[model samples]
Target: MSTILVTGGTGTLGVPLVERLRALGHEVRVLSRRSPTHPVDLREGTGLDAAMAGAEVVVHCASAPRGGDDVAAGHLIRAARRSGTVTNVVYVSIVGVDVVPLGYYRTKLAVERLLEGSGLGFTILRTTQFHDLLARVVGAAAKLPVVPLPSGVRVQPIAVEEVADRLAELAVPTPAGRVPDLGGPEVRTLAQWGRVYLAATGGRRRVVPLPLAGKAYAGFRRGGNLAPGRAVGRITFEEFLARRDRTGA
Candidate 1:
């Protein structure tokens, strides 16, 4: 059994991925900015050697959220190449990173390029929007009486659990370089999902459609970011919302 290292192993998806890998009898090591069993900072390039020592597979799931610097992912890819000890490197990226001109997506695309050029065996999984994103949108919209949604476009979001599973599966296989895009079983408009989220949360917020302008908004409105034919997730939006801790309460 090869030891696999997971960057950001304590994160939302990382937690479950680690647990699953551990159950499969693989030695699991985690890298994070704080309190990691094996503390390593990709940005600072510190403590990486100790964490990577003896690891055969490295699943690169660590990333900064929106508004934070994502160059760290690129740094981690460089570090993995320096290690030369790890085998497969699985990098988790978002779908439409090429089409979405957002800073966060742009950073991810750069990291993907870095991995491809690194000469290390790597697999790239570009997944659709996460189910949790819908919940976040609902929560943000609840702050105002009127929730504004883009009137013209649609989204094909996937479950984070499914994304995690795909990452785990790729860790053991040879680098399938740029695997097929993973999306949810259904497609829905932002307003439609917003309403479902509000109903599931028992919220009374009103959702108003808005005409979003600008290139980023147009990309989203034109469905440039969505991969409808790549649908693979089993969980529906309603199923995801209903499974929440306080659903219907």
Candidate 2:
């Protein structure tokens, strides 16, 4: 079995991808700042070489939720380049990173550039927002008596588990640049999603649409963030809500 290193193995997408790799009989190394098994800091380049050594594939799923994704990507690139055995560096990125003016998206785009410039075999999988992330957004909005949503914004939210399966497949293959973007089964506006969420969680809130002004809104309005042509995910938003309700998660 090939040795695989999974950075951010404990993250939203990383966790399931790691599990899938392991189940497929690939030896999995999980990079974690806390865990001694593969403790490494990509931001500081600390212990990164040690973590990546002897790993044939590096699935980079780690990110700072709030910010600093670019720095983290840099650390991973440096480490992977140092590991001579590393053949493919797989990065999970957002679909609209290239077009989105948001800081987080910009960092993701930066990482893609880093991987490309390194002259190493790499595969970048750009996916739509995960169901979990969308759910969290709704959960936060549910806290308010009036739920605020962006108007003219629709998202194709995919299941993290499905994304995990795809990542594992990509890791086992030769590197490809920015593979087909992955998206959910359906596209729905933020307002539509909010209503379904409120219904699922037994919450009542007035849904108000905000006609925001900004590049972010403009990009979203134009569907720059979605890859309808690459809609590979099978799980629907309603199914995600049903699962969430069943699990109380």
Candidate 3:
């Protein structure tokens, strides 16, 4: 029964989130710089107030996926403060925001800080790497005679849909602060995950283990981004591949 404003509505997370909210009987409006004309670029602070006019919840999911000018969550926090009508600001963050050694992760952590100090009802749901990304990694790694696996890397990847559902749930309620980390049901090594993907795709490839060095590689190899004992997703990686197979893409 709440009207929710979803930023980055055309992006990976935003598209599905808006659909879920609309399906659940909530009035949904998508904020973007291009389509739908609600033009609120969190990085620039434009069109935010207009989008927030009647929104009770704002799901801020408009971060750069890989490359950008690097605006932290603090920017959105300031925009929310200016809107002054948002009841809860639910932020979509990665599971290793606190443990990973990457620039994007650092930005996420800084944004979390901004949310904590913004004095508004807020929630942060930390999730693992998306399943689609796993497919990409697997496709790339399986190209060689033997898959070069990162030793000791433990990952529990979740479907994007599951993460979106969790965000939708958080959007409708009062901020629960930092919620439980959402992860896939089972954990797998980097090589095993890659193999599963290749096998599912009916591709011929051998799996080989590789010891990755450096801080970022070490962090990933040491299970820095997974949450095994926390929130478990319903979809399995194999099941996800099966679905993709049905679509024949």
Candidate 4:
């Protein structure tokens, strides 16, 4: 078994990734801003060198949800090169990030470019939105009397577990640059997702579809980020909703 370091090893996807890696019998080290075992702040490069020191395969799962994915990726790439110990760098990225106009998606795309140019053995696995994350967004919006959704926006949400499994599979070997995208089994409109969430959580709210303008909305409306042909995830949104209330499946 090799030493695999998982960044953001405590997040929605990270948690499951770590569990899966350990079950596979690899010596797993988790890197996070607050990880007690291997705390590392990719933003500051704090403890990153040590955390990455002996890692054979490093799964890059952490992200600055607010932005700065490029900066974080730069820091990790530099640190990994300096260590000269890491052989493969596997990254978990968002599908459609290259074409999406959102700020976070731009950051993700920037990170992909950075990795592509880094010359390090790396595999960037782009996946669709996680079901849990969508639920959180809908749950937050449910607090309002009217839950507003962008009209005609379709989403293919995959289970975090599935994303984790893919990351583990990619991390175990030498890097294959820009692997195929992963997505949910079914594609549904954003409003459809909201309805599923509202029904699953028993939250009552009026879903208001509003026309959204902007490059981001336009791209989303056009499905610029979707990879229908690469939809490998088996779990449907409905099945995910059935297990949503349960903690950490």
Candidate 5:
């Protein structure tokens, strides 16, 4: 079994990715600021080398949407190179990071470039937004009597488990750079997703489409974030809602 280190092992995608790796019999180390055993903050690079020591593979799932992702990636790349033991680094990125002008997407794309030039073996997987995030967005809007959603904005929401599965498969000793994009089985607009949310939660709210002006919003409207041709994800938004209802998650 390969000895692997997973960053952001406590976050949304990190939690399941760590579990999946461990279940596969890999020696998995979770590198987190709050981790009891392997404690390290990616932003500060404190204690990172110790946590990364002897780790053959590193799955970088830790990310900050608000900012500082590039800084964290720089630290991770430096530490991985210093370790001299890390053979593969798997990074999870967003689908439209290259085209989208969002600040967060720009940060993600910057990190991708950092990894590309780091001289270490690496793999980058870009996927659509997660189902939970979409649910949260819809839920937050449902609080208002009239829910306002972006006009002409569509999203492909994929299950976190499916993403974790793909990440696990890519966490092998050998690195495969720039794998195929993973997207949801269906591409639906925010209005459609809001309706799905309202129907599933039995909430009564009038959904309104709001046209927003911004380069990022325009990119979204143009479907820059979509991978309709690579809709390999089997789980639909409705199925995700049903599963959440069943598990109360």
Candidate 6:
């Protein structure tokens, strides 16, 4: 069994990935800022090398959407290089990160480049936005009397468990650089997603289309963040909502 270390092991994606890895008989070491055993902050790099020791694979799932992802990736790369035992670094990236023009997407792309040149075996899996994220966006917008959405933007929301499954399959000793993108079963506009969210949560609000400016919004409008050709995820957004409702989560 390979000794694997997972950054952000307590996160939405990392938790399921770690569970799957442990079920597969891998010795999973969870590295997080608040981890009791491996309290390592990726942004600062403290205790990272110690936590990475003897780890054959490192699944990088930790990310900061507000900023600082590049700094964390740099610290992870340096710590992995110092460990000498870590052979593979599997990264989960967002689809269309190269073309999205969003700050977070740009940071993700930069991290991918850093991994490519880190002189270590690496694999990258780019996936569409998660169902949870889409719900959060719609939920937040629904709070206002008039929910404003981008004029022409569609999203393919995938299940986090399905993504975790794919990541676990890639967290092996061998590295497969830049695998095929994974997308949700359906592609729907933001309006459609918003309607669905309202129906699920019993929310009633007026939804308006707001034409957004800037390259990032333009990229979103152009479907740069979608992978229609690679809609392999099984769970639809409705199904995700139903499950959440059942669990009261």
> Which candidate comes out best when scored by lDDT?
5
lDDT of 6 by residue, 1-249 (tens): 899999888999999999999999999999987888899988888999889888899999999999998999999999999999988999999999999899999999999999999999999999999999999999899999988887789999999999999999999999898999999999999988999999988988988878889999999998999999999999999999999999998
TM-score of each: 0.93, 0.96, 0.92, 0.94, 0.99, 0.98
Report the C-alpha lDDT of model 3 over 1-249, residue by residue, as the tens digit.
998888778887788999999999998889878856576776776777777776778888888757442463565666677776777989888888788787878778877877888898899888888888888787788887877877788788898899898898898747789988888888898888887988898887778878868888878876889898874798998998999899874
In candidate 5, list every pair of residues with a backbone clash: none
Provide the clashing-pair count of each candidate structure.
0, 0, 0, 1, 0, 0
Q: What overall lDDT goes with each candidate model? A: 0.81, 0.87, 0.81, 0.85, 0.94, 0.93
- Candidate 6 lands at a TM-score of 0.98
The model with the greater lDDT, 4 or 5, is 5
Maximum-TM-score candidate: 5
CA error at residue 146 for candidate 4, angstroms: 2.4
Candidate 1 stretches greater than 4 Å from native: 66-70, 246-249
For candidate 5, what is the TM-score? 0.99
What tens-digit string does per-residue lDDT give for candidate 5 at 1-249? Answer: 999999888889999999999999999999888888988988898989999889999999998878999999999999999999998999999999999899999999999999999999999999999999999999999999899999899999999999999999999989999999999999999998999999999988999989999999999999999999999999999999999999998
TM-score comparison, 4 vs 5, better candidate: 5
Candidate 2 residues lying further than 4 Å off, grouped into runs, are none
| Residue range 32-78, candidate 1, lDDT tens digits | 87853787777777788778777778888887766433567656666
Candidate 3 weakest lDDT stretch, 10 residues: 67-76
Candidate 4 structure quality by residue, lDDT tens digits, 1-249 = 889988888888889999999999999998877777788878878888888877889898888778777878888999989988887889888888878789989888888888888878889898888888877777777789999887899988898888888887887758888888898888888888889888877878889887988999999999976779988899988788787567555
True-vs-predicted CA distance for residue 166, candidate 2, Å: 0.3
Against the true structure, candidate 1 has what lDDT? 0.81
Report the number of backbone clashes for model 5: 0
